[model samples]
Target: MSPTTDRTIDFTTGAPVAGSLDVAWVHGAAGEPNLQVHHYDEHTVILRQSKRVTYEAPFLFLLFGEERALLLDTGATEDAELFPLRATVDRLIDQWLERHPREGYGLVVAHTHGHGDHVAADAQFADRPQTAVVAREPEAVRDFFGFGDGWPTGAVTFDLGGRVLDILGSPGHHAAAITCYDPWTGILFTGDTVYPGRLYAFDFPAFRATLDRLVAFAETNPVTHVLGCHVEMKRRRRRDYPIGATYQPAEHRLELTSADLAAVRDAAHAVAGRKGIHRYDNFVIFNEPGKADQLRLLARGRLHQALAKLTRRN
Candidate 1:
């Protein structure tokens, strides 16, 4: 694995090559198979919230180094004890510690952006010893990373001992949104910026710039995978789950490729400042809020809920 050499696909289709990576779609504490846990090498793990929990099935990532472990974006789950997020994380940390055998391991809990779905489970990490939560506000994030003038556009490195994660300035989807590149695994974790779901660009210009930045970074770096938080797409291209669908069968894979990034970038560019949904090969870019569309969606959700209630009662 040289710096100049391009990284291979690593693994294709369903899963990665046996030992290098493996994903298990296990049941949450509530007995729903909505949580997906992935072992991306020995140092990194990716956990996803299933659609059964909510439509905003966010993904939480854990990166372990020699000194400390970093968990990114606690999913929209409110109960950590029931979800057992920290306990699950503790197990992962303990395993990492077996080899290093440190008396106390430090943990930093941070968010990709200041959105409810991403930071809903923040309370889980609040009281834990040796754990710190990076504030999600734009100013607080800038202060914590010490980016100052380069707040949203600058890059900073989080050194978890030997491992370093480079955070790229990513705004648009949200002011505090960021993209994390892991040199250890060659994976870029893009929060809500680009995923298989509805790509909402509250700030169209910033979103476009962020997409361009990602494309450029992928070109310069050997990015094996472009990982996002949610999987709203189906196995079929250009298709996605609608709002308020609790269960999705035969969903899309959780990872996107570099070529997918180029496609996503083109899609975002197509909708620059435009207020509508523009479809691409894998995703759709939305520029602004649509009141009419929102009303229709709300009506449909209520109708669906009414039908469900009747069926339960019958």
Candidate 2:
């Protein structure tokens, strides 16, 4: 199916509107530098820290607001002394701020979840001026969004000047995973919950509940795009890189449709009690059990066995 809106794939190969992001997307890691920027609009820019630098291939989002821009998910590498992600961000922000030099715009460095791939660069933004790094701790994120002291998750709205972001605390994938809804663009950033990759369910029940909440929330809201942090699916569909594979060739699009979300919900509910991998046309959903289950799953192949040992070491 064609995209509902002009997205950042092969929609074009040229410049976009003024104060808007270019639709050009990033390709492979070879010859690609760090912090590859894909402009979506004046207010939205998607930054990809190449897999060559970080194997996770995590996408960091930079959202510009009248007050300040909010950065979601720092890259996996933590060499601030060399990489200096904050400095790269500042350089881009400097150019963006030059457009409206008189207007005051601060920065909020936040993460989608506390996984090492997403929050590895948290240290870089800790002491930046006019910038507050929301603690990776679940409680700190909950407090900042006023979700209260709950075990599971809840919803809250964060006002970023003219933009109002609906924050859905999604636990299950990770204890502090979140889904950020940008009302201005009708985009739902689902972190790892519904990404086009292995939907790793560390907690099956929590993941199911979160998907239900997201479905209901989308029912009431105008959601056109379900954007996730990582892209592990091959463009050919039903294919993905092996576990821990660094470079991705023929990578899938960064965005998923609501129908895709429903498919995920269906698969998740179907595999509610079962613990294994469920392959789909566009993605794969895997429910990870405990250590014993991991070893059992790994017994199938020497590669899997070696991966299990490496995973244990990490």
Roughly what TM-score does model 2 have, to 2 decimal places?
A: 0.84
In the range 136-225, model 1's lDDT, one tens digit per residue, is 898877887677788798888878776777888899999999898877778888988888777888888888889899999999887878
Give the TM-scores of the predictions, in the order they appear.
Answer: 0.86, 0.84
Model 1 clash pairs are none
Best by lDDT: 2
Question: Over the stretch 129-203, how does candidate 2's per-residue lDDT look in tens digits?
Answer: 888898888888888778885535678888766676889989889998899998777788999899888788998
| Residue pairs in candidate 2 whose N, alpha carbon or C atoms collide under 3 angstroms | 19-42, 20-41, 20-42, 21-39, 21-41
- Residue 57 in model 1: lDDT: 73
Best by TM-score: 1
Worst 10 residues of 2 by lDDT: 7-16
